[model samples]
Target: MTAPEWIELQLQLPREQCELAEELLLALEASSVTLEDGADQPLLEPAIGERPLWDLVIVKGLFAGDVATAPIEAALAAELPRAPLQQRWVPLDNRDWSQEWKRYFEPIQCGQRLWICPSWMAPPQPDAVNLILDPGLAFGTGSHPTTHLCLRWLEQLPLTGATVIDYGCGSGILGIAALLLGAERVIAVDNDPLALTATADNADNNQIAPERIATYLPEHLPADSGADIVLANILAEPLIQLADTLVALLKPRGQLCLSGLLDSQLEAVTRPYQRAVAFQPPAIEQGWVQIAGTLRG
Candidate 1:
């Protein structure tokens, strides 16, 4: 399909006003927004410290006409801390994004031995242990810091003949990595149907028989079932809420790796896991954090 012409509007709002900005952005997301790039391109700004401002990107088509733009502008002007200091509209033309996007992805090495390479990317030397992954919308392309950190931890952790459960298994990268690392069996769970399908496809790509890895929604897993390793790379709130249930999925002395969090959010989620697991300083990359811990007596 040909790419759509896009107008990129960059908005800078005060830090306290970011909430309103985010809400507005979500409203736009809910609507059918058009961007020069595919929907895969995220609009959220990279995490900035407690800065007093936030940058938001809104595609033009979503708010093209005067009627759409006026309401958004008026809403921001009314609810925002103050008038946005900056608002610029940049025109974007659709290009062959597939090739352009691939340029940003390459072989990613985790730990000393583990390597994650895109299927189209040349494999690393045979001597180096490699995990081949095909990038898709579902997440865990190994480019994300959290996924990289988890892959590194997986390399260091003992996985031979172990049962591993990947909670919120986006793209099934982590669980598949465990399988390639010698885990006997892997169970990948995700709430999204697309993620489940992607995970299954990725497993097949990695030569994992359907039986070797089981994919299910969280609601489908048996209550009593537990795993030797539990990995969750989801947001802070859900992580905290699922702490008891997640921990219960771990066998005594099992280990867990938690990501999709900021360093500041570490306490809220790790605190609950403290009863069964000892927390470790988070692994950080690109300003994102992933915490790890081992289940204790």
Candidate 2:
């Protein structure tokens, strides 16, 4: 049996009007709607609970193959008369939409010894420690500058036999990478249940022994828990707020790697920890920075 094709309507508009446009598309019975950066701008380190949009957004709507574009155009004109909208349409062939995005995810090598590869692809460097990953509902696929920075940092560290804590574990990539790099044990923590689940699943996928990695909600972390290394790849605000708590999780002389902040935010994020830890220069990539520090006894 042949499946029905779909039509994708795409329009560019000011960022401020994206919500209105999305609502209108839903009202018009679009099966799905997505927004992308129309100008290919970089959006880095959005705060928790904040939905940062690009200056120009491309709003796309998927509709039934037989739907008429005139009605959609008329509806938009009626609802947003002053909106500067340039609309185009493309026909989408019926296929596995779930797997379609996989085409864009490729194996990425971080620093000297690590590779992040999707499950479907073979490791580009056969001798490197490849972290098998798939794009999921949670974040951290190693493609983002922040994750890339963290991965690079991890690759350079002597993780062998170290105890590590991965706060805000996201997809558990950092913790799992530490495990693969010979960390004796890792404690993966996240506030989101889905992220915890993703971390556990990814760890298992990499054949990490159950005893080597422990998944936890932030509240579930033990009071006496301390690690030789701590990794927190969350945003600046929370990073500042949790400064003491993150530092407390580290053993004396342990290293801390903090990412997911803009270059301009380095001072604000580092100020809280400066009294307790000696920081290295920030590692910057595309306006994002990763701060690494060593805890003082």
**In TM-score terms, which candidate is top?**
2
Q: Rate the local accuracy (lDDT) of all candidates.
A: 0.75, 0.90
Off by over 4 Å in 1: 1-98
lDDT of 2 by residue, 147-249 (tens): 9999999999888899999999999999999999989999999999999999999999999998999999999999999999999999989999999999999
Question: What RMSD does model 2 have?
Answer: 4.5
TM-score of each: 0.70, 0.78
Candidate 2: pairs in clash: none
Local error of candidate 1 at 35, Å? 3.5
How does residue 106 of candidate 1 score in lDDT? 88
lDDT assessment of candidate 1: 0.75
The TM-score of predicted model 1 comes to: 0.70
